[model samples]
Target: MPALASHRKPRSRTRTNSPAVGLTTAAIASVSLLSAQSATADPKPSIDEVQKKVDDLYRQAGSATQEYNRAKESTAKQRRTVDRILDDVAKRTDSLNESRRALGSYAAAQYRTGAVTPTAALLFADSPQAYFEQSQLMDRLTEQQRSTITEFEAEQAAAAKQRAQATKSLESLTASQQSLRTSKQTVQTKLAEARELLSQLTAEEKARLAELERKREEEARRKAEARAKAEAEAEAERQRQEREQQEQSGSGTGAGSDTGSGTGTGTGTAGGAYAAKAEKVLSFARAQIGKPYVWGATGPSSFDCSGLTQAAWKAAGVDLPRTTWDQVKAGQSVATADLLPGDLVFFYDDISHVGIYIGDGKMIHAPKPGANVREESIYYMPIYGSIRPA
Candidate 1:
């Protein structure tokens, strides 16, 4: 098996037709050998070819690792399936054995009775055919006892065979998994070694690399911000449309309500409620724009949908759980339109997504992949319901 390392040179002009999992380790080792060959003053491959080979090995190694994991899971599951079935058979056989013993005791009692009344039974045997029938009946009863024993033994034998096969299969899968893992580790090791060997670069090279990375990050941030701005504008328009028609004649003091009356109309904080806390929550939530959305992230920087909600609530003298699944069940139930700005909105049936309701049919969410924290029309995603912190 080839040893894999993270830093390895490329293998060019070679066709190793390697198993996806084991190939990486071998590739890494090969690269190491190739580097040594270079030290021997052998003609070096073109730079482009070398880079391409390294890239190919990296891609191949990733795919092989994934494949190996999937295969190991499948085989292990299969072994478990077979083992469960055989266990069920063994339990049945055990029950049958107890019944067989009871039947044997009954047969013995009958045999004792027949022996005690042998003369009477002989006298009652009125004809040759009747006697012969009695004898055959006794033989048949004995055969039935033998048949029960044979059946029990057969079932046990079958169970044993199945168990052995399952064990063998499990062992095989375990061995294969270990082999793949070892090969992957070997390749990663070799690659890392090679990369270290070739890591000596001029200060200019390092500076240029840093500059390129910075530019890439700048471009990515610009794109994300543009997307956020567009979404926020669309959300503002949607909020206007949704609340415009729902204004009461005497506009309620709800902050989400439009102040469209000849008098005063605006969002209202709950009376005798945590006013300062709610305000802090609203601020913290709105401030977290363009934060990277990582699944299950709850941090000073990155966040997921539920993570944002939990953190925002925590800032406001409230506590929420860390995951969407847990946050859904963390609060009191409120009517569909009864949610406040700090209320949590659940999305999808499985409760895997959550966002804070911003009132007026608007919500702020991390959204899907590639989208950062941004305000959006609630209708953009499936709305499961709302939650109020307990």
Candidate 2:
């Protein structure tokens, strides 16, 4: 019996140890699989790749900033609309109160004079129409009393309509405020992401990244200069050809010469006027060259891309829309080759960025957060189009 008990204990031990060994083996397999995955995982991104990602994030933030600007502008306009609606409602309410008082006076006069009480008459009558019928209670009232009742009804309707409008406008204002909050959050998130990505880099990596950006900007400048030169040459060639045609057709003489000179003078005058405004815009932009790029600011201190352009144009006596989307539609669409100083040059397919053209294919702009208002080549990003705001 003791041998049997010992054998049973050994068997129990074996059963327990077998499951533990199986679990250990399974755990080891999992560890091995995880190790393989870790070994095959993608390597860390290079500094250049990090820079590209950062740039993309900034661009996304710029888009969100424009959305925030649009929402803010809408909210302001909606607030003004709501104020007007509320004011109208107040006026209507006053008028409604006066109408009610007049009706009450008429009813009291009828009651005192021993005629049918207005409320009693209305209750006994089949409907409001019947109560106001000429053959019914209205027949007992003088013209003034009858008119008062009609006026009261009209005033009541108008007051109700005004109240409805006020309610709708208030709702719209609330919606706009919510939209503004959402847009602001999107901008903040994008900017935070960009900052985090940049913060992850070592100091040496950041320095290298800056050098990479410098080289990229340099290349962009070179391309921009080359494009400007090409466009200028093409324009000159076109003028030369036009002159040759005029000379060959004898259109450069007498009346034709006078007409040509008149046209030239008009063009020169217009050009001079534009040049003056352009100078003002450029001056304003240059003054803001060192200001930090704030997402939604339009100010003496900091600015976003569209804000900078809007402020600069405002300084030049032009009112540009607050967002890049609206500003793009605020002026004459100009070709890239036709871009002149003071033109609002937009960037990105979505038209999220804008800069004041400073000629020579360069633009003064508030580039992005972590940067400042400065001049850079237009070719720094994809060009959407240009607008002659003047």
Pick by lDDT: which candidate is best? 2
What are the lDDT figures for the candidates, one per model?
A: 0.59, 0.80
| Cα deviation of 250, candidate 1, in Å | 9.0
Cα lDDT tens digits, model 1, 1-390, are: 997876867767865675885879889999999898888985644444444444444333333333343444555666676677667667866865674454445344455665445434533455323443565544554665545545655665666776677677667767666765764575465455445423543566546545654665466456545544554565566557556645644553463543221110122324325444556777898899888765435667877676688789898878876556667788877665455566788866656567776655557777543358987656554568877684
- After superposition on all CA atoms, how large is the RMSD of candidate 1? 19.7
C-alpha displacement of 332 in model 1, angstroms? 28
Error of 2 at 191 (Å): 0.8
Candidate 1: Cα lDDT at 19: 86
Which window of ten consecutive residues has the lowest lDDT sum in model 2? 258-267
Task: Evaluate residue 119 in candidate 2 and report its C-alpha lDDT on the 0 to 100 scale.
Answer: 54
